[model samples]
Target chain A: MINVKQEIINSIKEITVGHDIQEFIEEVLLSDLGIDSIKYVELLVSIEEKCDVEFDESDLGADALKSLGDLINLVNKTLEQKVS
Target chain B: MKQYEVKNVPRYFEPHVNDCFANAYATVLSYMGNNPNFILTDYLNFMYDEQTEHIGINFFFRATPTVEFSEEELNSSLELAYLPATSMFNKTSPIDEVTDKDKVQINMYIHEDQDIAFTRLKERIDENKPVIVAVDLFYMHFHRAYQREHGLHAIIVTGYDEEKRTLKIIDKYKLSSSDFDGEISMDEMSQSRLSECPLNNPMVGEYKREIRNLWMEIDIDPDFKMNVERIYSIILESCKRMKGQREVLGHECGLNRMEAFRKDLLLKKESFMDRKLDERETYLFKTYYNSAFKSISRSRMRFKVFLEESNLAEKEDLGEVLEQLENALKRWDICANLSLKLGIKKSIKLVDDIVRQLSSIIDIEGEIINKLTDISLTRDLVTVSKNIKDQEM
Candidate 1:
């Protein structure tokens, strides 16, 4: 079984699909990776499919996905809650 | 005003006519059952409702006629036969009073063998007179069936085209007079029977009546979000099956349909391998995949060119033109960036080329739209732009 940290990272990688993760993290959200509202929805959808978990809108807050660590932490908390 | 015969319809509405019949029938059902201004969800809901007593609804927008006909049939039903009902409604929004300063009259009895209503609608157009036609082709199809089913003799000649001799009249199911070799004979129409009344054979009349209700009653809600979830689900499901087949073979056999068809496929297959990738690695994959997919989808330059041609041909209102252009750019960016990330190099080039061409048209459309800004004009333009965009794809 994949851990929450790895799952979130995998989700991020899946979102990027081609390049290195750090480069994507720096360029995609901070600069313009062309992430519009629709694309964001698509990203969430892909994550949900890959992880087999539904993400609440609240969990998808802008601040929650600001950095790699924050995203990993959010996923861990969500997965822990799911397990409990 | 041109006249054409309707025959060789699909098995869906076999021996009836085109897909328009099914679409029209649905429209009628929707119209009869639901309140006006209902959204697409409401439209789907009305269709899903199973109650036989409830009216069925369906609708069609901007459909082209299929069959070809003669000048006589075209002239006889110009105003009453061949015009879009929406155009008439759009022109006279207050609903009631419409001027008939340029109306033409034709001698219906003059054609002994042909239908009077059909003849007049066709004949009038031969003289070059504009007509207000009903936009409900769905209505036309159902009404035609209803007439044949119910033996109804009455026919309403709805519209006609002066230039083409096309008559857009609704005899029973709102079928145009031109769709037939000879206008539906009133005597023949009257003799037709509905296997039994609604009180007797509910099934027979049910389909026809349900369709009729949709056209008359259903209202389309302006706000519609096209859900691509269903498409995505299908794609993902196919991917899953393919992956499952690959895992079962365990590198012993090669990829083929036989692997998937094997009876023990599920048992032999392995699960999606679990991997302990870090946060950064996961992010990279997701980003790349999303971008790649977008780029692949947006790479069609023909679609962009079609949109431009449609805009020019239709000369739709400017505000709408600008709005569509902006939406196109948004879509382009989403799809193009995704393609680049996906490692679909060909798709990236296609997306880039389309985006460049589209950008120029967007600028031109934007300028035109900005120069003219009236509420009415803007609304009309938006409608036109939306129609063009939907059809372009």
Candidate 2:
């Protein structure tokens, strides 16, 4: 199984520039990290690349991707689904 | 349910003025089997408010000196201008508070649930009704440039497929050839309906979709004479009110709006001449000038068509006024072309020449509008006499 937390952190880092990585925590809201709709798309694209899985519409529901920790959980779930 | 598409719906693009409501209304009327020319003429009547001001530019200045453009205010202005019930135009407004008592009905509905919206859309389409949906531009995959830009726009949903999960739409501002008749995934369409963006208000990061569904039912008036009289009265009132001060937006009508735009352009040109123009400044100047020119020119063309197609043209001396308006429009076109060239070449001489020509055209247009206004008032009196005669008989 892929390290979903590390992959998500790495993907977020790739999409966002000029931000302090140390400030990021699992509980931090994605909006607080400057993840707008466009940037959110970018983050998803980066994570999909690392996880080798594409996200369906249902997978990107607003409630499913509320926080950084939530996104990490989603990445792990999608990865598991892809393996199955 | 069987699928149906409204055949030969007349499509119009008023990109510079943002007349999506008019376009959508026209589509609805055409679908109801109304004469396209008559419908178009009615559309032109809606362009001018009761005070003869261009509805799009009738912005209310909320506070001193600072002009604020609110879409909500504009919608109210449009309603007042069209006088939907009398003008034979479809009544439309935001879904939350649509209380139009007009026989010709158009209403909007918002649904938070995508499935319900989709089912409702398909049901309407099956019944040969085209639904106008307001969506955030960012999530509409077909609009690539606007895919990242968050702005609320309305498009006609012509068809949908449950099996393919695709939606067929008609976008008036077809940026590319492929955009005119386009399709987007249902998922994307739903996301766009729910998507919130910062374009309208930066402070409010999410914009709730206010107009999700548009409902239209047309009841065309059979009395041509009555319709003509109503139109003439509206035009006459607009002309008379042109002189009155509007509390919102400094200008009352097209002539005043053009005057304001000309003065603003001249001031901007002078500042650019004083300093080297940067790329951003040049782009902004081009956009402002182009939009202003196109809006006036297109509206003038529609006004000409309205005059020609409607019974109002038969009024004595009205033809001459129409000719004068045409001449002014032609001169304005030349000035706009020169202005465009000057923007690119940055020639001070050209700037001065354009400003002079624009001022002259504005004067000519103002004179023509006043003449038309007077003529329409006289026509109104004649109509009143004719109506009285009919009643006495």
The TM-scores of chain A alone, one per candidate, are 0.58, 0.80
- Which structure among the candidates has the greatest lDDT? 2
Worst 10 residues of 1 chain B by lDDT: B39-48
For model 1, residues B1-393, the per-residue Cα lDDT tens digits are 354332222111111222233223333323234211111111110011112211111111111221122334323112211212321112124322222322211111111222433453344334332222222222223343343333212223333434544434332222222232223332332222112212112122232211111111112223322233322232222223222222221121111222222212122122212434343333322343333323322222222332333233234543364455445434444433432332222212233333343344334433423333243344457869999999999
- Where does model 2 exceed 4 Å of error? A1-84, B1-21, B35-56, B59-105, B136-152, B172-179, B197-226, B244-270, B278-281, B313-316, B332-343, B346-350, B384-393
Clashing residue pairs, backbone N/CA/C < 3 A, model 2: B50-B238, B51-B238, B52-B238, B53-B253, B59-B249, B60-B248, B60-B249, B61-B248, B61-B249
In model 1, which runs have C-alpha deviations exceeding 4 angstroms?
A1-6, A15-20, A23-31, A34-74, B1-45, B49-393
Top candidate (DockQ): 1
The TM-scores, one per candidate, come to 0.20, 0.60
Q: Is the docking of candidate 1 incorrect, acceptable, medium or high quality?
A: incorrect
RMSD of each: 25.0, 18.0
Our model 2 lands, by Cα RMSD against the true structure, at 18.0
lDDT of 1: 0.31
Q: Note the DockQ of each predicted structure.
A: 0.02, 0.01
